[model samples]
Target: MSRHQRLLALLVPAILLWPPLREAAEASMFRHMLVVFPALLAAGWFVAGALNARAQAAFARWNGMGLPGLLYVTVVLTIWMIPNALDLATVNWDVDVAKTASLFSAGMVLALSLRQASPVLQTFFVGNWVTMTIFVGVLFQALPTRLCNAYLVGDQVRTGIGMIVLAAAVGSVWAYGIWRRWRASAVVDDGTGVQSS
Candidate 1:
C-alpha cells in the first residue's frame, strides 16, 4: 500500500487513544478491555507494517533466536489481560502509560513472531491464546462480584461476552488460515513445484 494509506490506517487506531474515544474507553471495563486495547494494538501493528523493512528484519531476527522473545511477549500479554491491570490503566496515569506501551509492544512482538513462526507453531500459539480467552471469559461471566474497582458488574458481563465472541471469531479465522496453509503445503508435496487452486 501507499504511504498515505499506511498513515491513514495507523491513524485509525491511534485515533482511539484521543479524547472522545479515550473517554469512552475509560468509561468502562468492556470498552477498556476490548475496544481500547484492540485499537492500540492495531495502531502498533499497522505502524510496524508501515515502517521500512528494518523493523521486519529485526522481528525476524528476534523470532529466529527462539523462545526467549516469544516468552517475553507471552508474559506481557498475560499481564495486560488481567482485570486489575485494566483497572490500573483506567485510573492511574502511570499505569495507563505503561499499558499503552506494553500493549503496543506486545502487539508488535506478536505480529512479528506470528509472521516468522511455522504454521504449526502459529496454530499452537493461537490455540493456546484463544483457550485462555475463553477461560477468562467464563471466569468473568462467573464472577459473583465486580472484579475491578472502576467497572460495574454489567461492564464485566459485557466484557466477558466480548471475550467469548472474540475467541470464537479468532478461532474461526485461525482455522481457515490453517486449512489454506495445509492445502498449499499439500500441493507442494508432490515435488513438481506446482500450486493447486
Candidate 2:
C-alpha cells in the first residue's frame, strides 16, 4: 500500500476516536454494536500495518501464528459483543479507554493473524463472525426489553435489524468470494473432444 493509503487508514480510525464521532457511535445500540466497533478495528488494521510491521514480522517468523492467535481474536470479539460489556465500555471512562486500546489491538491481531492463517481457518473466522452477527441481531430484535443500559428498547431493536442486514451483506460477500475461488480451482471440460480447464 502507498504511504498515503496507510496514512488514511491510520487517520480514519484516530479521527473516529475523536469525542464527537466516538459519542455519536455510542449514542445508540446500533451505532455502538456496529459502527464504533468496526471503526475502532479499522484504525487498528491501519495502524498495525504502518506501526506494527516489526512486531508482525517477528511473530510471523516465530513459527507463524497458530490456533492461539485465533483464540485470542475470538475472545476479544466475544467479550465486546456482550451487551453488558458494551455498556461498561461506554459508561465507564476507565473501561472505555481500555477498550479503545484493546479494540485497536484486537484489530491489529486480526490483521497479523489473517496474513498467516490457513484457508480453512480463515473460513472458520468468517463463519464465527457471521454466527455472532446473526445471534446478536436475533437477540436484539426478539427481546422485548432493552439489554443495554446505555440505549433504549427501540434503539436495541433497530440495532438488531441493522445487524441482521449487515450479516446478510457480509455473508453474501464471503460466499461470493468462496464461489469464485472454487470456480477458479474446479476442472472443467470444454467441447471439441479435448479436456480443457
Candidate 3:
C-alpha cells in the first residue's frame, strides 16, 4: 500500500476508537450510523489496498465473483441498521467492538471482490442495498416513536432523511457510471460499413 493509504487505514480506526471522537460519533444516532460506520468500512477498504497478491488470491478462492463478499456486506449492514443494534452498539462496548470489526472486514471484502464481479452482479447487489436503505429510511420517518433507546425521535427522523439522501446519491453515482461506460462502448455503423465514434 502507499503511505497515504496505510496512514488512513491506521488513523481512521484509531480516531474512531478514541474516547472523545467515539463519544462524539455515538452522541447522535445520525452520526453513529452515517459517519462512524462508513468510516470503519472505509478504513477496511484502505487495508484492502495493502493485501499481498497471495492473500488476494486466497480471498478470491472463497469470494467467487464477489457474491459471498457482497452477501457478507449486505448481512452485516442489515443487522447494524436495526434500531436495536444501534442502541446496543451505543451502550454495550462489546457489541460496539463487534460492529466495528464486522464493518471493517466487510469493507475489505467489498474492495477485493467488487472488481471481480460482473456488471449484472454489481447492479443486483447495489440495487438491493439501495432498496433496503430507502425502506429503512421510510420506516424510520414513519414511526412516531423512538426505535432506538439511546436516541431521540427527532434524531431518528433526521437519520432517516440522511439515509434516504445517501441511498439516492449512491444510486445516482452508480447509474451515472454505468451510463458513461455504456456511452463509451456504443458504436455506430453507416450503410457503407464505416464506423463512427
Candidate 4:
C-alpha cells in the first residue's frame, strides 16, 4: 500500500473511535466539543496532503517526501488530542472551546509549514507561532479560573501535562523553522544545486 493509504488506514480507526471513547467519559459533552476542532483539523490536513501528493505524483514528483512528513505530523497531533482512556470529565464547554481553538491554530501552522513552494510559508509559520504562543500562554495563565470547576472534578495533572506537552511541541516547531532557515542560508549551493532564495 502507498504510504498515504497506510496512514489513512491507521488514522481512520483512531478518528472513528475517539468520539465514542470520549462520550463514555463523565464529561462526554465537553470532551466531544474539545475534540471537534482537532478532528476537523486532522481531516483538513489529511485532505490537503493527499491532494498535494496527488498533484506532485501527476507532475512526476511522487517521490517527494514532504507530504508524507506532513501526514505523519498530523497523525502525531491526532494521537495527542485523543483523551486518555482514564480521563474523568468529558465535558467542560469553556475549556473545550479554548482547546479546540488552539488545535485549529496549530493545524493552520502545520498547513503553512507544508507549503514547500511558498516563501510565504515562512511568514505564516512565524506568524502562527507568535499567535500560538500568545494563545497558549493566555490559556495557561487563565487555566486556574477556566479550569477551576473541572479541576475540582477531574485529574488536573493530566490537563496540565497535556498543555505542557503541547507547548513543547509548538516550541519545537518554532525552533525547527529557525534551524531550517539557518541551514538553508549556510549551504553554498553549486551551479548544479537549487538553493532556496
The per-candidate count of clashes, in order, stands at 0, 0, 0, 5
lDDT of 1 by residue, 1-197 (tens): 66566556556445655667767768988778787777777766666667678867866775783355456666776787788888787777778777777777666667667767777777777788789898999888898998888889988888999999998999999999889978778877777766555
**Total colliding residue pairs, candidate 2:** 0
Off by over 4 Å in 2: 4-8, 11-17, 51-54, 62-66, 188-197
Kindly list the per-residue Cα lDDT of model 4 for residues 1-197, writing each as its tens digit. 35486346335324434665434543432333334444646654554444454564553353133444344444445433344412222354344334444454445335534655344544454445445544544454445543434333234434444555555676677678777976777774545577656
Strongest candidate by lDDT: 3
Kindly give the stretch of ten consecutive residues in candidate 1 with the minimal lDDT sum: 65-74
lDDT of candidate 2 at residue 85, scale 0 to 100:
88
The predicted structure with the larger lDDT, 3 or 4, is 3
TM-score of 3: 0.91
lDDT of 3 by residue, 1-197 (tens): 58466656867776787778888899998999899888888888888988889999998998889999999989999999988888898888888888888999898888998898999999999999999999999999999988998998999999999999999999999999998877665645434676666
* lDDT (10s digit) by residue, model 2, range 78-117: 8887988889888876777777777777787787787688
TM-score of 2: 0.84
Between prediction 1 and prediction 3, the one with superior TM-score is 3
Residue-level error in angstroms, candidate 4, position 93: 12
Ranking by lDDT: 3, 2, 1, 4
Which candidate do you rate higher for lDDT, 1 or 2? 2
> lDDT, candidate 3, residue 80?
97
Q: How well does each candidate superpose onto the true structure, as a TM-score?
A: 0.84, 0.84, 0.91, 0.44
